[model samples]
Target chain A: MVSTSILPLQLDNVSFEVRGVRLIKDMSLSFPAGPRTAIIGPNGAGKSLFLRLCHGLLKPTSGVISWATTEDLNPSDAQAMVFQRPVMLRRSVAANIDYALKLRRIERSERIHRIDQVLGRAGLHRLKSQPARTLSFGEQQKLALARAWALKPQILFLDEPTASLDPAATHAVEEIIDAIHAEGAHIILTTHDLGQARRLSDEVIFLHRGRMLERTPSPEFFTQPRNDLAQAFVRGELLWWNLGKDNRKNKLKQSN
Target chain B: MNEFSKAVAVAFQLVLGLDHQLIEIVSLSLQISVLAVIIAAFIGLPLGAAIALFRFPGRMAIVVFFNAFMGLPPVVVGLITYLLLSRSGTLGTLGLLFTPTAMIIAQVILVTPIIAALTRQLIEDLWIEYEDQLRSLGAGPGRAITALLWDGRFSLTTAILAGFGRASAEVGAVMIVGGNIDHVTRVMTTAIALEVSKGDLALALGLGIVLLTLSVSVNGAAFLINETARRRQS
Candidate 1:
């Protein structure tokens, strides 16, 4: 396996526009491997779009993304992403993991072994025969993580894996994510949970309204954010003028 | 008054006696319709998937044409087939102007678009939900379409059976192109028309019952399949 670490990732002047509205502006950054980097920002901060660009799901109108690779990138097999909502196939839990394994042409016995390993790791082995959609919301998120874990990608991009899960499920998912990182997979995740960022992230990429505000180490970012937008966002202050006090109090629990 | 009573009484006898001709027509109609549906599915499903997954010039026009084709007048299609296969027409050399094959061709043309367009609509709606996830998973264009089509098999089955139901019940195109030749191209729908015209209510009504039964079966099967899909999706 070639190390995605060798060259890391470079995005130069990356921009994405939809119907004359810029979603991601002249953004340029290099994402080095081997860190649990959390991307955080306001609702429309283009954090999700930036993650999509990193996953090669979106093409920039005018920028370049280059990877440093020791050997061939294969590009196809080197990455996996779990969307905010688990994008489940209309299949059984076991079949879902098998489908991912089949993509790389793993032998059937090895595929079965891998499925058992990941499902047990995520504590979903008991529900392996059940249809994936039948699982509770939290369980589905766990299965999604298990599916991605089974892929063993060089880069795992997760867009808010715990956004909609319950507390126990969230804790369980975080543990699995930590376990995956321990096995040496670099993780790039996006979230609005400040506490989660504080707990898991090695670095933070602070974005606001389609532009990078600040990219700093996690401890430094939480203690003293340099960008006004990042600072306000960290304190649960209003980014948009219309945010009512009640809505903020209800939805904005400072994470970590 | 007497004629009406006779018709009704004979209709009962036809039901009780298992009339061979009426049964033959009903069975043949099922055979042709089933075969046509199978063939149409083989062709229409992939064609619909291709149209939805790929972009090229004239794609909109093709979709528009298929949508329009869903409501095509059976008589007009019959007339076109008649003209093409009639003596001194373009295809007169084959001498298939009034045959079961001609009837199958006409029904195939009438129903293929219905199957294709319905499949296209089902896939198009699902694509809205799955497209982003699929692209992000590095599912190239071909694999994405294949996955979507396979995922949507339940709805596709309904579309195909709908086409089959329409093909079996349709009369005008088969009547004209098949010439309703006795013991040959005669199918349930055309035979129904013939027997009704000749005051042979017994056979016509018996065949009509079989046709109704088939329609009911198709609807029941579709409901079951749909329920299964719903359970899985939920």
Candidate 2:
């Protein structure tokens, strides 16, 4: 939302490990400004781990993740993140936005204006004075997005922002994410929901077993995956350890 | 049974009539204990929060030290304070011993570690839930501690009350340092101890009743506040 942007985020052979088990293995990718990107993978695919490393919430065990930084700006100042389960401060809905803004060191009057503007846009104006934690699950997620929206972050990292929502709530959240994207902020999110990836992303990065198997435009990637594992994933066939489970179940069904 | 009933009668009359002597003891007790809890919170909450937030070479040892000191015997604290304030001792020139100031100092010393240790625990739990979001928002260590303390304020109130509980119920430290001088440093706990030693059963029972009521009232307030917070949080 500013004249200058922290775009073209580059990751060069980055790998993350914990307790001797690698979660994100030797991933090197470049994310330019414009199109929304979704990292799609099954459970334990290290999608969230990759997102966290890029967000600077965790350090890579090896290699480098860097942003195009300006001399005057801290990389953190230009980005914000919304977790799967949003954390609400024990305060009013308005104050939650205010707190994030205050941390950004925005002036008093600007904070008030931003809080007012964001809550109004997010349909949270009616709940402005209500305690944030008391909000229902769907409403809490929306509030989380609104809080991040108030920051006017140049890049928003959403870690499965809609993973735990009902249909109506998911629709609303997708709309909000699109709205944020339309406002010229770069979007990077991780989702296991294939339909969500198809609907929300311009490009898809398929991850399997801590590795990037493919990166392609959303439609072409879904239609023709280059990797054999990715093709099986696109075909809705279980692969890896899950393939063994699927085979046993099929064999038992045949016997029965 | 007859004597017990008579004691109960004396306690009720003293409480309902708001006896001047009882009021003096209750007022002085509130003054010293409340002041002690306030000062302790200022020092202890930050100390606990810092310990919870930062990592150093001997961090675990410092944490264990404070946890052990939460149960520090009041007599030991009293003796140490007495020595420090004695005429020939290092801080003796200030001449604080045997005064209400000395009693307040003793209570502060007794209460701070209780507050610090409890706050360390509360803030540590909160930090786990908040670390990712806080770091993503660009908050450094100092900001994280402040934000966490504010969020955990509801539970921390009880921790502070625990500190107040120690301060108000303690007699040994205040007794040694204050000398229990009437119209000067006599508080409810020390007065109760004195009247019991003198075999003034009626007055002792009366003061004991007042102290119990005060304790229950503070705890009740803390409960009500937490209940309200829970409702709002849900």
Candidate 3:
């Protein structure tokens, strides 16, 4: 399914506005085929909005978003998303995954095989018969991921997948994410947790006030940010204020 | 003994002996209400689902109209059906007036709006929770609606029962349309009304007991089904 035309999904001058407030401003970005990219920003910085726009859940107000794929292959069929709160159908865990596979028109035999594979992979085989809503919060999240993975999409967009989980549950979900990434799907996620961004992402896009201020390798972005806002953000300093007196003095000296 | 006490004694004898007139009246009532509910469901379920899922101009007005129609007075429906089926009236050629068919038509008119309005409320709420997930999975509007309707089957059943309750207890529409013809179109509610006016209080009280039992059973069955669904879900 590797087609040369489909690689490097592109967004050019994408902007989204609600009412009159700009949520994502004139932004052009592209995601390559295989990187796990994390979008990190403070609250209301448009991280989730940007992810939704790229995932085709929301249309951009101004520019073009495209997957340059072969004509026979629809991009949506090859892509999937998991929301932060992990929406599940009012059915059994197995039925939820089966529903997704059925939407793709996978044969019943293949669906049965894939369902078992994903359920066991997500450590949810034991709860296959249980209604999804009856599962705990963490299990619901796991089921959501399992459901998405069952589709075997080429790109997976997750909006704050682990934001609501406890630490132990968070660790479990991270491990599942790592397994998915290792299996060769491009993963893009949004999060405010800096440590999680550093741990899970190879590339980091730091957004501030609805603008992409910096995009760099995760380690370099955390260690030495080129933008002041990103630098302040990484240092755990208050974003609206100067870092400290010493840093302010250094900034003045540099300006002179 | 007072006339009321004497009537009560006759009512008990009629019930215990399973009087044929009482049984016939009860059976016809069940048949008409059940058939009316079935017909209403065929029309109302999809109508409600479409109204809930789709967005168009005048949709809210349509919704409000259905909601208002839920409380439609049975007599008004009876009058309308009566006019339509009357000789020289529209649909007069069918000669359905003073027949069970006309009675069924009136009940359908009364029950449909109730079922459709309740269905809209239930399916709309489910849609809010399931929309994003189904869309992401590439489900179109039809499939999404079907999935919700199936998952909400228990609630939809309750809506149908509510329609049945409305149809079974209604006297005005069926009375005007069916003409309450004995042994032909007479049902429990219409018979009770006729018997009471004629001062045959014994038969009226008998039919009343049967009607009460039927209503209670329908409601009890709905409650049991709802409890089963809730338990299975939990």
Best by lDDT: 2
* Alpha-carbon TM-score of each model against the true structure: 0.91, 0.95, 0.93
Collision count for each candidate, in order: 3, 0, 0
DockQ of each: 0.51, 0.79, 0.64
For residues A1-256, write the lDDT of model 3, one tens digit per residue: 5664355789999889999899999899898888899998788889988888888878999999999777677888888899999877778999999989999889999999999999999999999999998999999998999898899878889899998799999998888888888887899999878989999999999887678999999889989988776786787765444256577657646643
Native contact recovery (fnat) for each candidate is 0.46, 0.83, 0.60
State interface RMSD in Å for all models.
Answer: 2.0, 1.1, 1.3
Task: Order candidates by TM-score, high to low.
Answer: 2, 3, 1
Q: Which regions of candidate 1 are displaced past 4 Å?
A: A1-7, A239-256, B1-6, B83-96
Instruction: Point out where model 2 deviates above 4 Å.
Output: A1-3, A239-256
Better of 2 and 3 by DockQ: 2
lDDT of 3: 0.89
The DockQ assigned to candidate 1 is 0.51
Instruction: Give candidate 1's error at residue A208 in angstroms.
Output: 0.4
Residue pairs in collision within model 3: none
Mind giving the per-residue lDDT tens digits that candidate 3 earns over B25-46? 8988888889999999999988
Tens-digit lDDT track of model 2 for A147-179: 999999888999999988999999999988999
Q: Candidate 3: which stretches are off by over 4 Å?
A: A1-5, A238-256
lDDT of 1 at A35: 79
What are the lDDT scores of the predictions, listed in order? 0.83, 0.90, 0.89
